[model samples]
Target: MILRRALWEGLLSLVEDAEDVPWILLGDYNAVIDNSEVCGRAADTSASMTEFRDFVTAAGLVHLPFKGCPYTWHNSSEGSRSLWKRLDRVLVNEAWLGAWPQSSYLSALPRTSDHSPLVVLGIVGAQEAKPFRFDNFLARQASFLQSVASVWRHPIHGTLMYGVVCKLKNLKSVFRSKRKEKGDLASNVRQAKEFLATAQALHEQHKEDIFLVLVKCCRMVYCAAVKMENMMLHQRAKLSWLKHGDQSSKVFFRKINSRRARQRVYQIYNSEGECLTEMHKVTDEFISVFQTLLGGVRRRRTIDLSWLRSDANYVLSTGEGECLILPVTEEEIKEAFFDISEESAPGPDGYTSLFYKAAWPVIGRDVCEAVKEFFVSGRLLKQINATTLTLIPKVQMPSQVSDYRPISCCNVIYKAITKVMVKRLQQVLHLIVDQSQNAFVPEIIADNIY
Candidate 1:
């Protein structure tokens, strides 16, 4: 306890003497932030945790969120004697937080020691163009509906599908403009507080009717500004505060940073055993790996299905065959749109089911027509089918591009169309599929014969 106090005083002294520069003090500080940070034993309120907390508060430090095991150190004991505590942490001040908001701390599994290893990931560079998403908070704005309607109602010359695409594209720009016009929530909150302070002072001096009214109005605006700030924080945290009680803004901000860090690929090794750290080099390596895998020439083998004719059980009935090529209807298209998940990640075109559902009144007819045209012409729009390929790591600390699996994110329109076709096929799938082939069939047993 004496050593902990001395260390806390030393940290405070350092913070006071050092300039306001970005710095991260991480590692085993032999202290837990709160009771929740410890397990297997009741936390002692009278312990040195308060001293550490006070030190952190005085230093204006923020704790970065960690991924993986919650506890960093564990006691090697059996039964009730076993204990775990998060003695290691990555703390940063306001300057550090501002400089690298996307930085993260990863708690790796303990290998030769009882304490888990901590890995601090630094921000790499400016992110790519993020796929556009509809912010639910924006729905609360008074001008939101008007803005969307104004942009979507504009006439566009072309085919129905083309017109819908044009209008959505135009609306995207309008939304972007409005987002900018809303300004920074932090700045707005500060200004609102200043206005409220001035109004309160005036009301105190004069105690007149107009001053009183001004103070009340200012108070309302200030409260709204604070609420908006909380809303923004909630969105960034990507967690519903209603379900899980209120989480500190600092904790939410750190979670955002941790998420970004986990998704980021900083470096990778090529097949030649050469490590590539530069952003462009790593990107080119990934491209080369994918190209070799996906762009390779292949010989197509022809399979005769004459044997299938000999087996009448494998053949589709006349009615079933006819149903396969049935025309897609507007109702089916609308159902497909509504069936898709609103929160699913967007593709390269930056559109989700939520956006379509929200603007359905204005763009539904054209969107339906566009989808129907694909069936008529047997050709899909390139933009609509364009996908964003993301790489998911197959193992911890993956070094090679091959160690990651590539997943494609297709646009919502394409997904909906495919979903409808799949639903139709599923209805007749059991009829033609052999009983022995239980792979794609639902509720089928294929026990090993060997």
Candidate 2:
């Protein structure tokens, strides 16, 4: 099944449809081009090899030079384990070949895998070594003076020694003064001019040949010193980058880990159906922890408290199908519904539905019961206040609501039922009123305020 011709053709078609790119295809071919390409004894008419060779030719690909490690595959049969074939190859497209005229492809000896790895190198415009030049050097005063002194003492064997020595002494003094101020190209040039003038004077008083010799000697010393300085500068820069390599690596991995972690969280939060139950089970602890983090989720700054009842209606939409509840507004169901639709894989139900079909009716009933309880409790509280009028004529109201005991066992029942019912009411009020959004107690009171 793995070696079927259709599978090979399908793979090739996939590559052909990819975005235009300069690609170098590399991997074990598992088939030979010719009898010579195979290492172990083989039959001349191997069907797989014949198909592979034809495919390469059809694709207009050329095998590159295989050097150093010739055979790419080996036999693992215990009886006669031997090197067995060169089936691996690297095939580059025309664009790649055009870009790298000098490229060479080769196969390496197999290591862990039965198939050897194919490698490519020396693709056109490969880097070449450049000869060092004196002009590229840079140095400070101290080094420049030292180089001058060495040249003077050495005298290049046969060059004029007397003039070179006089130039060296003048340059040494100039460098010492320049070093005190600061060393730079401007200062170096100034020192060179002064030394040249002194040498010219000495030559005029002595011999013309000596003047020319001293001029040449000074220029050569300056060039050598400058080159040495540049080399040192280059080394310092490279060393700095090498020292910070670990820091750069840490930054790279940090970004990758952060991105992957956020993606996982989003995937969980946006899932639905049985997956949502799983997501809640897995991420509820994290959400609870996040809730502890102050200001993690922001409340809308400007809430439309005036239009809350109307806005709430827009949010509550009727369910459409088996998974959907009938009474809840369509928009209210969208959140749960859409969440399930976007996961990489379907939820536990193996279907992508926005709302949990079986669960929606239950959720809808809960919302309706809660809203009704809020109004009922609010009405009961008003009735109790009216009844207190005759009995409280000689009595004074308590200083605080907490000081008042529940009227009776029935009063306690009202409080318990109202408290449980207000949870959604608190959420709804929070969404509508800007002031009440972060204040849960106000919403709880508002739910029963009527």
Please name the candidate that would achieve the greatest lDDT relative to the true structure. Answer: 1
Per-residue lDDT of candidate 1, residues 277-328 (tens digit): 7889999999998988888565655656786588667677788887987988
Q: How close is candidate 2 to the true structure, as a TM-score?
A: 0.26
What candidate 2 gets wrong by more than 4 Å, as runs, is: 1-4, 18-20, 77-83, 122-450
Write down the TM-score of every candidate: 0.67, 0.26
Candidate 1 at 21: error in angstroms? Answer: 8.0
Q: Which lDDT value does model 1 have at 322?
A: 79
37 Cα displacement, candidate 2 (Å): 1.1
lDDT of 2: 0.43
Error of 1 at 386 (Å): 1.2
Residue 285 CA displacement from its true place in model 2, Å: 73
Q: Lowest-scoring 10 consecutive residues by lDDT in candidate 2?
A: 386-395
